[model samples]
Target: MASAADNPLGTYLRDRRTRLDPAAFGFGGGRRRTPGLRREEVASRANISATWYTWLEQGRGGAPSADVLDRIAKGLMLTEPEREHLYMLGLGRPPEARYRPVDGISPRLQRVLDGMTLSPAIIKTAMWDVVGWNRAATLLLTDYATLPPDGRNILRLMFGNAQARARNADWDSVARFVVAAFRADMTRAGGSAAAAGLVAELSALSPDFDRLWRDNDVVAHNEGVKRLHHPVAGPLAMEFATFTVEGRPDLGMIVYNPATSADAERLHRLLAAAPDG
Candidate 1:
């Protein structure tokens, strides 16, 4: 049989607790038996009984509740990845998302998006806010850099901007698809509260938005052909694909590639004409 100290959950908890600095967390230390905080100190920080904490370390404590584990994780001063690991150890799955806004993507992710030279690529938040885009997106799609932050939202651009509507080959079909996909994507990303303000505002402003939202239809933003009537390039058909950013459930990437040689040539010409954008 495995030793009590060999329990995976207990081992993980003990390891993380030992990794914490007692002095940094305002715990006074004169002479300590161990390198890290004592079981009592950890228990005190976690707001649990010291005895129970001891039981947990010895693998005698029953499975800890998610709430208790959360408290313990906070007490340990765990980072997001560490907290997630704690949840996975304590519970059988990861915890629910805390629903924070994504300010920006990492440099690696930005590089990945930027690497798509001819392919228009954009990184968007769960709430459909365009947080990052490549030069191809500016040349072939919308000029995201020129727009203010709020104006970069996919939903806002689709419904609020007349120019965006005119650019779509079939605005009604595209709008419906976007609304459905938005519903599914936001829900999956646990962004309902963040999306609520935009939802309410758009519903009040656009009857189409109100109707589509009420329909309660949901669609996956998988792969599809998008037709747009670009002012500079004329009618263009592009095949677009969506991908979830690795380790980032709150962000999604969409890449659009020209469906035909003619469309590709048009995008190339458009890119060549745009001066150092």
Candidate 2:
């Protein structure tokens, strides 16, 4: 039998396995004795040997590394909190924050966005995909609804789309800022496969993105001043700040405030003229 300290990890793993719904992963239409995934199934999904996984479950295997734990977490489709708990139990420490792509937003949060009538606000995943936005955001930025789902990624639009590139007054500086911030995000995510894939795709798509990514710069998305040539309004100056969404640390919100009264009036006029979608 394993010691008290060692046994909890195994017990936790067992509990997670039992709670996981098999059908969610396309393992449906099967009759089984147990409620959740079998040891072999989890091992297969995690790309580890069945015997090794069994050993870990039996508490005979030595402490798993962080990388191994991460793989298991992904394999099990563990939520961020669950992944953190797994790391604490398995490795005696919490894992670092990672980029998580989330689309779900509570109605209360949407109401908060809606209430910010004067500010252009948008909620984005760690990868900078625009998942939610207020009316002011749609007016200030491109109408997200008009773009393809995948095209809503901020970095992709900034670098890959001609319209976005043309809208920015200082494209080079903004591009650098985006690349640097994304690099830092990737580091926090432990260079996840999703991050790697996005990098690879962007590098191939835009020469500027490729070059900036290779420059190896890193930055935090805190606050910044922006100057843009709005197609209708023209020469809009704004100040923007980013905040982590409450209860969802992996998601971020950017709120753009008008720097001058003139800009505020311009936004109001633009919003008034724009059709509600």
| Residue 231 local lDDT, model 1 | 92
Positional deviation of residue 73's Cα in model 2 after best superposition, in angstroms: 9.8
Q: What is the lDDT of residue 108 in candidate 1?
A: 87
| Candidate 2 structure quality by residue, lDDT tens digits, 35-136 | 999888898899988888888888987999888898888788888788888988888877866676665578988899999988999988877788888888
In candidate 1, stretches whose alpha carbon ends up further than 4 angstroms from where it belongs are 1-6, 43-69, 90-98
* Root mean square deviation (Cα) for candidate 1: 2.8
Q: Give the TM-score of each candidate.
A: 0.85, 0.68
Model 2 CA deviation exceeding 4 Å by range = 1-95
